[model samples]
Target: MVATEVGDKRVDYIPGNSSIRLVDFPLKDASFRSRRLLQLALATIPWAEKSQYLLFPSIYELEPQAIDVLRQELSIPIYTIGPTIPYLSHNQVVSTNHDYINWLDNQPLGSVLYVSQGSFLSVSSEQIDEIANGLRESGVRFLWVMRGESSNWKNICGDKGFVLPWCDQLKVLMHSAIGGFWSHCGWNSTREGLFCGVPFLTFPIMMDQPLNSKYIVEDWKVGWRVEKEVKETVLIRRDEIARLVRRFMDLDDYEVKEMRKRARELQQVCQSSIASGGSSENNMEEFLGHILHGAKP
Candidate 1:
């Protein structure tokens, strides 16, 4: 199923133009309850085909092969104007001093790990406990963004880390004190991590997350997987998590140094794509030109 082609291989979609793995496809396994939502999401494909234009919130440089292939296969005009994150907000000054920012500022450069599992579809309490305990044991300085009951976070994280309900995710990732990211591999988080040039510790949950993790760990070689296999039944213990976190945070590690290097390279690519006359900029201009000039369908 992983190697099975879904359509013509005339265009290079996946790396080497290989067939998308069954596991890599979004919503690979849909339960009866989720089937309706899955159908609704899938319905967009045909709808896009009938439209005059299609806009992707992604950078052409990031997925050149996929974007190029889609333009070749599809009849309508397609534009990649992305990294559409709240980058503009970064310049604005906050009225109040955030404790998290102060904490990050005090930490040594690239000495902290930033952890967030995403706002939706969180892991089980058991998994959460394991992760929290593991970070405590790892002896690494970390900033974990978690929602809900925070009463026991101090005990769980010990003195090595800070836990909060939320923070400016992109801002946190871009901080000089942040060394690495422990992420759920959501596309938005993944993009932010790449943009900030931070290596990842992928703990993907579902849907596009697993595929994003694959790209981070395998294709990009900028990160490592926290879970060898993503299964609810498989609980990664505290000791293992501690060990992985330790190795990941070790900046002196030769492998880690290389991974960080690759991450920076990708970050440069992301930056260039958004700069003047960049791929993303050009695409945005073209898209607006079409609209302003009232180009025919």
Candidate 2:
């Protein structure tokens, strides 16, 4: 799938059009955007023009309307064989440190909030400080995966929350204790959260993150956005963060319960999509059959 930022206007690819430009996303430096656009133009233009099929790590169950729209617009077969992480995992067990897993085991189910902004994107130190304080003030049981430069989560949240340099995100999201996620709304994270039935305190930073956030909050009805306006100059206040966290994690709140209900429903849909004879599984088989039979480009 073409991974462009989504917003008020949907970005579309016109087949055979050479003037398609990568849409602008938040927090990118001017020079960086120029270079990235150039790189994408070089890499995707020809590929998009010629590729026979486009495979998205998505399932129609999650976005039937969107998939329907795409099918109508696109000229080629666009397969939705996703929650793709599981198939890609190949059932290879990854070894993880036992300490965090053990800690999660001790906490009550739906008690902990997992916070991570993914590996590549880094926020400003001021924003980081706000997030740390927000987590602390929320008074929620949390596990934050920090980057090497942002190792101060321990100091920020103290012993109230667990701070790790890195851990298996899939493992953490699936843990019984994790009730909510404070995330950048990256597609992988979004899908994982959906798979786990965990609602989000969305803090989208860049690229597809915003689009995924929109889908989570608006389309899916499973999460809430931390900041309405995501800009480099805008810093999310700690109070808003704390408020959103409480709203998402508070099991008693009617809205929170509704979000959880929707998330769990979506989680089941995601699971069923990948199960034997399910939509994604069937699609995968069809995709393979097409390849084996040498479908035309």
Among all candidates shown, the one with the greatest TM-score? 1
| C-alpha-based local distance difference test score of model 1 | 0.82
Clashing pairs in 1: none
TM-scores for all candidates: the values are: 0.89, 0.83
Model 1 bad stretches (over 4 Å): 1-21, 27-29, 32-34, 88-96, 230-232
Tens-place lDDT per residue, model 1, 1-297, is: 222243112223554333344555655545663466567778877888789889888888777777888988888888887877766333342322789888887899899999999998688899999999999999999999988876568777998799998898888887888999999999999999998899999988767787788778877889999986534355899999999999999989999999999999998888888889988889888889888999874
Clashing pairs in 2: none
Residue 104 of model 1 has an lDDT of 81
1-297: candidate 2 lDDT, tens digit per residue: 123332223434634222212322432434576458546746775675366888889877887766777677767888899888753231222234468877887888899999998898878889988888888898889999888954656887867689988888888888778999989998898988998789998887666676677678877889988876524356888887777787678899999999999999998899989999999999999989989998763
Q: For candidate 2, which ten residues in a row score worst on lDDT?
A: 16-25
